[model samples]
Target chain A: MKVGILGPRGTYSEIAARTEFGEEIEPVTYPLITDVAEAVEDGEVSVGVVPVESLREGSVGETLDALAWLDVKVKSEIVVEVDHKLLGTKDSKLNDIKQVLSHPQALAQCRKFLRKNLPDAELISVTSTAKAAKQVSKLRKKYMAAIGSSGLADLYDLKVLQENVQSGQENETRFLCLSKEDSEPTGDDKTSVVFYTEEDRPGILYEILQEFATRNINLTKIESRPSKKALGDYLFFIDFEGHHEEEPIKEALEEINEKVATLKNVGSYPKRF
Target chain B: MKVGILGPRGTYSEIAARTEFGEEIEPVTYPLITDVAEAVEDGEVSVGVVPVESLREGSVGETLDALAWLDVKVKSEIVVEVDHKLLGTKDSKLNDIKQVLSHPQALAQCRKFLRKNLPDAELISVTSTAKAAKQVSKLRKKYMAAIGSSGLADLYDLKVLQENVQSGQENETRFLCLSKEDSEPTGDDKTSVVFYTEEDRPGILYEILQEFATRNINLTKIESRPSKKALGDYLFFIDFEGHHEEEPIKEALEEINEKVATLKNVGSYPKRF
Candidate 1:
């Protein structure tokens, strides 16, 4: 399989791509999540893997907004455990590091370790941890290190100066595989959709929720984003535990359509535990 | 009035501090939103002005999270129009610019202009636009420029090479003046609160919204953030047009408290239009 992913090659998105597809999958790299989705839509790749949510970061808005704007569907989901490592050239020692570089999120995750160990090191933010690792490899700077995955160490022939240096030990990120084709019903699935209410009334949201409540459908996620036209205007992104083609789900969607200004189904895929 | 703000003297936050308080007020600067909130909580400042939301970027999660964690309350709100300018050293020219520096958000807002004008110029991200201007002034690089408010030009003794470079003409940021004392109820007031549902059931959210629907309160904003413990766990932040002490609003709160697992009243203050 050919998978489009946010990458320089050894980032978490690459890890997610490898997890969802086999390790032998061909990887096409994109600079941003929107571009990754675009590659999938334009048939440059069979599928795209992008992080949808993080335990501490809430929602990855860029990915969500891209999904809402593009005519793509979710093919599968995978949750990857985040373990940020301190990578350095094989000849370098931890005490020799005078600078650190990584993506902002990865840098943030390992803030405590960085502050305590390399208090005087110049911290730089790059586009991705993989890119940082690549730069470190090219420079072979004994006084520089990059925070990335252990897989990056193997990919770039670097060494893990420290393992799992992130402050939050329980961090995990959820990734969604995007494609033009929707997943078939697997009996256990989740439906994702983005919708706008017809009016900005107090009970308008309540009325829409009633449709699902009456049918005993369980919602897994609900988030609101500004429509970008005004301050208070919003669009909701919801994920529920049922395929859209299911009878009760279809009826509820019809009822919801009557009360909403617009609705777009993001597609149903088998739930990943 | 004394206001704490995020600053290096010429930031938009400093402008907000001057706008909400008189120009004569003393402005204290902090490095982070949490520190500003801490200054207010620790009685170091009477009030603090922090950007809470922007038309493009949803909520400033740091400020929202700080408000939730601290004992501070909202005193007033102000909205500032974001007009980014291309700033340069005294002897610099636009044609000579080979690099640009600004906060990532400001850089993003002016992507179209930069692509057209300085396509080959290296874009560098700094902690704040004010800091960018500071760096440009110190370096005096004929080929370097910064994107920031026009006020920064005077503060850093730089020149405004170009005006209104942001892509969105309607860009504005909503700032909340946080204080230890809550504002007394004005006839037109907005109440803010954060609450968690007892369970993630289909109808549980509808039940909470019904409390406000029956009370005839108009909701201005509603956003959900993950509780950070797990994927589906969430907390809702709601802003509505009513004071907590008001009769119907009081009853709605009582009803909401009965149905939710936990509720936190952020505060009520006069709405800024």
Candidate 2:
């Protein structure tokens, strides 16, 4: 099977894909989350994996946007523990590092570590952690290092100088496996839905949430994103316990459908978290 | 007055600061949102302005984090129309641009423009749009361009190659003016609050929303972010239509406080949206 991921490889999205599909699957790379979703929608790939949220950084807006707008359903959810490591060329020492590079998010995650250890180092923001490691490997400079997964050090022929450099100890990223159809009913599953309310008023959202509350459905996550039409206007994405096929969930969604202008059922997937 | 902004300068944050204060106010630049908040908290600047949300991009994670963790209050909210321009060296033409550099969000906002016009041009992520313009101006290459506010062209000695390059036409970014104290009730103000519920039971959030609903309080925005403690754990940031000093809002908050583990009133600010 072919799996699509946000890439040039060695990203947490790839790790999530590998964790879901195993090592024997063929991996196809896309530059953006939208691209991965498009590939899944077009059937160019059997499945696409994209990071939906990180414990430290919160939800990935692009991934949320893709889920909200794209014609793709989430098949499963994958959770990966983020293990940020300081990688440098073999000859480089922690004290000799004058500059650090990584994706901006990764750099922010390790802000405390960098401030205390490499206080004067110039922080360069690149596209990805894997790309940062690649640049450091190509430079072969003793004064350059990258913050990423230890796997990057192996992929880029660098050494892991330090492990768990992120500020938070329990850093985790949640990824979604996207396909043409959602999974079948699982006893332990989660349903994701995106909806927009045409009217902006007091208790509009409260009324919508009442459906779930009345049904006793536990919401795993709820976020409001800009509708792109206006600043205050929003598209709400909600994830709740129970599959869509379940009677209570189906009833709640049916009731919610009456309160919102547009509603899209993103998918029902086995809950991993 | 000294106003801190997320900047090298000419960023939307700077524009927000100028909009909130005035053109004559002294502008202090900080490299990150947290730094801007820190400056305000430390009295390095009387007030700080940072982008909180964009119509196209949603809430800024860094700004949200700063609000949750930093000792700053939202004195006011400012909304600025996002006018992204394609900037380049004096001699650069649209067709001659081989690479585009910008903050990741800016680049994402202009995804459609780049895909249609500069199909093969490399997209480079920089620390900020202002930094991208600075880099492009320094290089003075016909093949280099940056996506940012048109004001950047004047600051960096570049020319505006194109106007309004972002994907959406109705793009607007909401900014917050941060200070030691939140604004006094303006009658038409909004209160922001961040809270965490220790219990993960169904209807916990719905019950919290009921406090507002029962009192007929309108919610302008509601979002859940990872608490960084663990997966599935969240800190909810809510914006409601009332001043914290209002009797109904105060009563609702008291009820919510009893329900949640912790609740912080981020501030009451004039609602610009």
Candidate 2 residue pairs that clash: none
Please, what are the lDDT tens digits per residue for candidate 2 over residues A139-173? 99999999999888888999988888998654788
Best by DockQ: 2
> What TM value does model 2 have?
0.95
Across B1-273, the per-residue lDDT of candidate 1 in tens digits comes to: 678998668888998888877689888987567678989999999899988877555567667776666899988889899999999988888899999999866887787899899999988767688889999999998899999999999989999999988987437888999998778988999988988774666777777888988878887777676666454556788888878899999999999999887788989999885
> What TM-score does chain B alone reach in each candidate, compared with the true chain B?
0.94, 0.93
Compute each candidate's TM-score over C-alphas.
0.85, 0.95
TM-score of chain B of 2: 0.93
| Residue-level lDDT tens digits of model 2 in B1-273 | 889987677888888888877899889987667888999989999999987877555678788888888899999999898889999999889999999999877887888999999999999877788889999999899999999998899999999999989876546889999999999998899999999887788999999999998899998888886675554466999998989999999999999999888899999988777
lDDT of 2 at B127: 70
Lowest lDDT 10-residue stretch of candidate 1 chain B: B225-234
Per-residue lDDT of candidate 1, residues A131-195 (tens digit): 88988999999998999889989999899999889986436889999999879999999999888
Residue-level error in angstroms, candidate 1, position B218: 1.9
**Docking quality (DockQ) for each candidate:** 0.38, 0.57
